[model samples]
Target chain A: MSDIVEIHMPKLGESVAEGTISEWLKAVGDSVDFDESLFVVETDKIATEFPSPEAGVLLEILVPAGETVPIGATLARIGPAGAATGASPAAAKPADAAAAKAAAMAAEVAEPATAAAPATASAAPAAHKGGELLSPLVRRLAAEHHLDLAQIAGSGANGRIMREDVEAAIRKQLQPAVSKVAIPPVAPVSASSSPASPPAAKGDKVVPLSRIRLVTAQRMVESKRIAPHVWTSVEVDYENIAKVRARHKDRFKAETGASLTYLPFVMRAVADALHAFPAVNSSVDIEAKTLIMHSEVHLAVAVDLDEKGLMAPVIRNADMFNVRGLAKAVQAVSAAAKKGTLTPDQLQGSTFTLTSPGPLGSFASAPIINQPNVAIMATDGVARKPTVVGDAIAIHHLGVLGLCYDHRAFDGVTTARFLDHVRTSLQERDWEAEIG
Target chain B: MPTNKEQVAEEVTYLDAISQALAAEMERDESVFLMGEDVGQFGGAFKISKGFMERFGARRVVDTPIAENGFTGMAAGAAICGLRPVVEFQFADFISQAFDPIINVMARHHYRTGVPVPVTLRCPFGGRLRAGPTHSQSIESYFAHVPGLKIVAPATVEDAAGLLISSIRDNNPVLFLESKYLYRRLKVPAPLSLEPTPLGVAKVAREGTDVTLVSYSVGVQQGLEAAEVLAREGISVEVIDCRTLVPLDIDTIVKSVKKTSRAVVLHEAARRLGYGAEIASEIGEACFWFLDAPVTRIAALNTPIPTSPPLEDAVLPQTEEVIETLRKVARS
Candidate 1:
């Protein structure tokens, strides 16, 4: 049997379903001892190292680096030192995947020891709908969210809407993609959609949705419902900025300890264009049915936390900032995000948005409009592309800029103009003037 | 059930209702008299017996010194002689001083000697006035356990009058509890003929199919309020006022509970062995299988009433608590 042994992923926590393999510490065939960190895995909550249960040689690594597989799936295998090729555990067949996923999900949903026994829902409900009332807090939430109380089935006494039911409904309202129509006939429409709620899954492994994921899910649903988002994209040539940045890259970093990136240059152009088209730097008060335009542009920059989630911390009042200042603000915000010390106020009061999916290697994206705010712009990756320069073909630093604006505030033409303005600003910024 | 058709009358305050019941009973029987610390000249502590002296004369409305134990013994002696005596304690807390006369003499007179002690002890009770622990007490729960005495607490003006008259006319000694908070606050139609509502008969103050809410005195008022709030959200709450505690109207409670499959009992007394607990136990025994949820009890915290307005308010059971308990019970 080659004495082959497999090191499956361990149960992480009560709420963690899957963990990303951040790095494999021991490569295949590396000799290891018990308690040695074999690999590092990162859940949304924390990054933990898995230790070798027994002293052995590291064998085949099943899951690769950066892949987020269900927890308890085989990460790597180990055996007696210098075990030959046939000693490795065979790859999981088709049947193994489903079973592994279910086990991983079960661990995430393990109730705390202190959790009281749950109330059974399937017990034949006593006949008749009585006037079982909702509490003040639950009522307030239903009113605030405009949820139909009749539509929500309460887990409360006599089918009353306890605070928990309302909270579950509020969470479900955020993900319109999973609304009644979208929830396949597997479960009832009025059933709880909370990640914490137990779903009657025959083969499905449901895990609790992380807090960040819940918030993003809600915002995405709200933005789609409130704003008629119209997107327009324009390709830009960044050859001049590339040359200017290449010339002063080392000096800029040495002096300011900040890498001069195209984001700051793009942010500078966005601020300038926001000033020209002031209507774009405004929010829609849907309730009051009013449009509020801002004199100063508080630019929200969408920073992806290595795909854990997205956080758009505002670079408050970016219009007055030059290229260097914008770069510093971007760098400061990104650093605060990495250290997880960003203040609450830093996240709010965004009048316009600039998202750099460029760093994440996206060539083009139609990002959703950050609601209340009239517009959001996605900075696509800059790559070398051939362009005709006065009838001669030449390689240039090329990028695409996409703008998604609220059509409630303006038409497609105006949004296109705003997008064109951003494209022109990026292509024509006098980079040498600022570089010197 | 004898058919005596009763007519609606004008509205009266809870205090006036008590006053009218005393005057009407005294005039009808000629032997019924009232005695308390300030009941005659000063018109009682809450003026519940106000103007009784002017109409009934000093002989009938006899004012006594601040001696609950002494005067209560005298009243028990008078009841033994065929005089229906209604004795008032300024606040219910002082009833503890008269516990000997209540349990030993008046409560056991009919059983011990076959002579009916038709004495009604009027106790004005309940917290939430910033009244300290001694003054604001719901003490019926203590005597509710006594075998010989009938504990009757009234929440509305109508119940206060109807139950008081019934207490005065009963053969056994009765503890008539009137919530001080609801004394002059709640008003109901005055009885044109002083028709007494039969004792131990529970009144469904508000009806709903979802759950049955059993409460007495001030707790009934809170249940009504909780019902109104819940009704706005479409939760139908059935509130029952168990006017008489000792001879509880279990039939009314059981019927409502059996229909709803959920029940909750509420009172202003401390929760540990409170009257509500007695009702809960009875429900568990009688309607065990019919219940969809465990019977719940809502009562004041098991602590003395605080003098601080906020603290005292916190100690007493609230409509919010009733709403919360009923929500859980109905769902269960």
Candidate 2:
């Protein structure tokens, strides 16, 4: 029989009973193929795309994106293509409360990281006789028992005659003679099932962690546990650098085909500061309790990754870079990283690092220190804010530089002094002359 | 206590182990003797009593005529006189000829005449080798229904030897079923325990949490194979070998059922009024609330044995049947 299947919001995590629709890959009227992604849903732990269990036309969109619904709540309906719509409202009713309850309970007990299938096929009773697909074993058994395949009611996938179907038939034929002792059939356990039921997790897809992500995770966890992290932030007046960028940005972009940003200027100042205070570019031998100061200031620049994370690739001998040189190096390294063209040699031997949330408009961010590097700084949003200059209020370009340092190599006062120098160097730069 | 299977040495096949136990027991007690057809020089039908003719005298390992009734009668009388007689039936299906002596005489000797007849009837049963019709019949259900007769069907070499020692030592009459398939099919280390492993005890052949699988004799081997297949596919199966058939270790079966919340029983005998029905009924009554699914049974069709290989396979219960039944119960 032709029946409409309801696609429900999947419970992506063990404790999560609801998920907000992030986006619908297919519109309500689109015809979906079996196992094709219908929509993307975001749970507390991850964002997952659910596929259509059966190939059919999407008839309705019940819960729009940005709306959170309880697990097992119908988000869409898929029916046979070209079938008349709104013909069977009664068929869409919640017929199996026990099954729906069981699905919800199963989702509640599901593990948080497991990709359990969120949407499920309807629990409507299957009509087993007419078009059941009999397996070879089932067919052999039926022939042996002289049973007409048309007489058996199958409960397998798509109303197929699984071994259970034949066995159930055989059991029915043998029941009266075999069971003279009045044996009670096992009570149908229609109660809420455990979270491990495979059908309940069909909507949950488990994408294995990529190689980069896996290595990044392991290194991040090791760095967090090994280092004693101390964070300090300083408000920087960026009026001068902002003026420099505005004056020369068009000419710079025309010459280099790349945007001129404040990070390149910040990097130039950090390299000089590292040269002044060599301890800030040193690595601590935690086992020997000695600081191994680096001679070359190999500065690592953070590149924004695909939404979830990032990678910091080092620029070799970065201390020698002037403002223009640093800006060009940043453009090339970041572009190479984004294009997946970064070589292994280019990403190694960094003595200091910089990460910026400036473009994304973050007020402040404590960037994690890359291992073997004593300090890392984050450049916060550059916005025009009112500040006191010469005892009068003036609207000047303003920002904050957050420095996260390893306290094992440098104390609070030394880290503060480095930040003060970086602020002074940026605020007192000759804008037009530096660009020229 | 010595543990670990690696510690045990000198492996023996299931049939040889049975012979080992019989010879060991006969050596221990002078009164314990054996009587069966061709048990002397011919070494019985399957050679289970092979070297017994040389080790023990002909008088002890006496060869009898084809007359099952006459020979079984003499054995029963010998037991009544406190001789502790052990009778060997070439095939269990032939036990129908000696049923009068079994049910009427040896089975209820203590209740009828107040005389404890310690008799052990070694019956070789089950089918797998194209030994059709009469020779391959599994008639444990027929004798299991009779009171005063304790039935033991051993699946492993250890059980074949250990359970037999316990059966011989018991004061009541015992039906010792040796799986014809497990005779030379399975090899295990010679039993270490001088003491019997105890009668009326079921063994957990393989431990799991998903579903409880119950079977006896070679069916236990089939259940284990099915358990392995299910395990690989991520379904955990608990296999319980009902070593003793009549006075079944129902407690162990119930405990596994309570833990797994699902159960399936299998037997080579026909499903119509077979012993598995009774076992399933008992499990339902004992652990009804704990069950997540119904107790299922996989057994042979109600038709008689077919001499054809493929036909016999289709009729008999095997690993496929066990796996199919278990997968359904486990899914629930």
Candidate 3:
């Protein structure tokens, strides 16, 4: 309690790296209570006041508002009321620091701060010391490696084991075992790596990318780099679904508060077509030269987040939902996506991805397949065009459905037939009943 | 598949993105309109809608008297009548004047009668400009407590447009907190995407294997800066931009914490019961077993912002603080 308690910048958010001090409620030498508001920190995403974690006199203020600092940087310091400020070299001595650390560790264990203590204590055998402390990560790693904590030398403060320490111990134990067994010769690392790009040209403007843009760019590049893509498209008459949509859109909106778009119809058709042509709905295991045909139709719908980037929120079990149900599900998921309310689970485990370029009036498109999904389908714009019907010229809704697939997973004919099945389903299905 | 509808983007300031989003929504939907003090003729205090009055005409961008409560209540009424009204408060601090209408009238309209009240309140918040107490305040926490009120604070140019569009389209009361400090500071390639950025979902500004730093609004910029500095020191820090306040994205925070085993919540609002507290508590509860260090929070001092630049500087949470804090937490 007599030692100075330093206040460091708390990690604000998972992605936030720094913060700006906006204001300070207390001036230097102010008698501050524990958990009292101290100062405001404004980051790229928020501005908030920080409370004092410990009670003491505000001995120092290291940062001012408008100045930005990285996460974990010390903002200020608190000390005992009678302790001298501006100079506390005695506290920094190795012996004193060790004592302070020991006290802190003891406090962490004695208090309810370490929530895992009860569980750890309950699981411990009689041989285990009551005072021995291990971080959850170290504890888990110890269990996984089947290593006794007592045997491993800890490098952390006060002999506390760390992840790196455990990893080193594991490596040391594996070396002798590996030397005794027959081991294959390891390949040399690549010698010719691409050189760094030349410095920016004179008078050239440099632009920094947002996180979403960076991720999208990386994923797109990786997808294209890894997979050899083959695209196939089919022209289909959408008159049946268009008629059904025209009849039920108004009533559908009234009942469900969602717009009845052609996407859900396309989704249903694709789901059925995928079942008919399982090869088109699969993942390619390049090394094994095997195709994993996913039983569940987890459709990943690529939602445009404007120029920020794109996110593919998955709707699991797409085959189970009918046109109406799919329409509701798509609407809910898309709305959640647009509103930034999507959970992490909604973004994973997609067997197929459906991207619609129809609303943007695209006639035909071949979108990149989302990773782990063998193929991606795109719905193009539908228009009323004159076509031969029973040898007579008639106006009908027409559109193109395109599929971009992993060439390694299936041949061109598989995608071609898959598109044909989808086209046939859209052109001839009982859409009215499906819409209902 | 070929996404032939790829859009060409132009660079713009954060303020211009907001203006573009407002105009785009107004043009896209007939039910959407604007109401605020001097929003029409004056084009807003910061000139966010400088030419909007001329472009959209007075009918869509209506000017109002200096009565926040009156205009707020009128906007709520208009929303109930099947119109999406975007009400702009000159300063977020002034929102307190219309708190009754926002909390009592607009917040619970749908729950009480099932008829949606689609009203978007655009509040210019945050400090660092030395505008003094009344003009600069982070008021999201106030409305965040009220149920049914969605609060979104976009830190990037793209999100400023996308989230605003989603806020206007949302069929409920939404407080769109536009940071005044970021109005002209942050810039991005524009032709800004009008796609709606989903609310309540957190964006990972930077992915890292070390500690997780959570923040929103202006705090995000600080977090990014801190991460860059820490990266040079071989400290991999993950920064999460919490775009929305109400319906806080605890899942994203929890997930990140589970991976890194350490978390630090940063913000520019008062520390006492600030939004960061909620995040810290959530991480504590959700990732207790995964935590390597206690969840830490860095935020503003609980005091009204001052006019003097130096005094204001003393009160705020600076980037250095965040850096030191992150270093300590990461190592510990």
| Tens digit per residue, CA lDDT, model 3, B67-148 | 9999999999999999999998999999999989988889887889999999999999999999998887888788878898
Top TM-score: which candidate number? 3
User: Per model, how much of the real contact set is kept?
Assistant: 0.07, 0.00, 0.12
Model 2, C-alpha of A69: deviation from truth (Å):
39
What TM-score would every model get versus the actual structure?
A: 0.45, 0.45, 0.52
Chain B TM, every candidate: 0.95, 0.95, 0.96
Tens-place lDDT per residue, model 1, B195-306, is 7989989999998988889999888899999889888877788999998997999999998887766788888897677888889999888877566566777776656777
Quality of candidate 2 docking, DockQ: 0.01
Candidate 3 lDDT over A214-238, as tens digits, reads 8888898889888888888888898
Between candidates 1 and 3, the lDDT winner:
3
The CAPRI class of candidate 3 is incorrect
For model 3, the stretches where C-alpha displacement exceeds 4 angstroms are: A1-133, A139-147, A150-160, A167-436, B1-10
> For each candidate, what is the lDDT?
0.78, 0.79, 0.79
Candidate 1 per-residue C-alpha lDDT over A148-254 given as tens digits, one digit per residue, 9 for 90 to 100? 88888877544555555666888888878557446467645555444474656798877778879999999999898889888888889999899999999899998
Best model per DockQ: 3
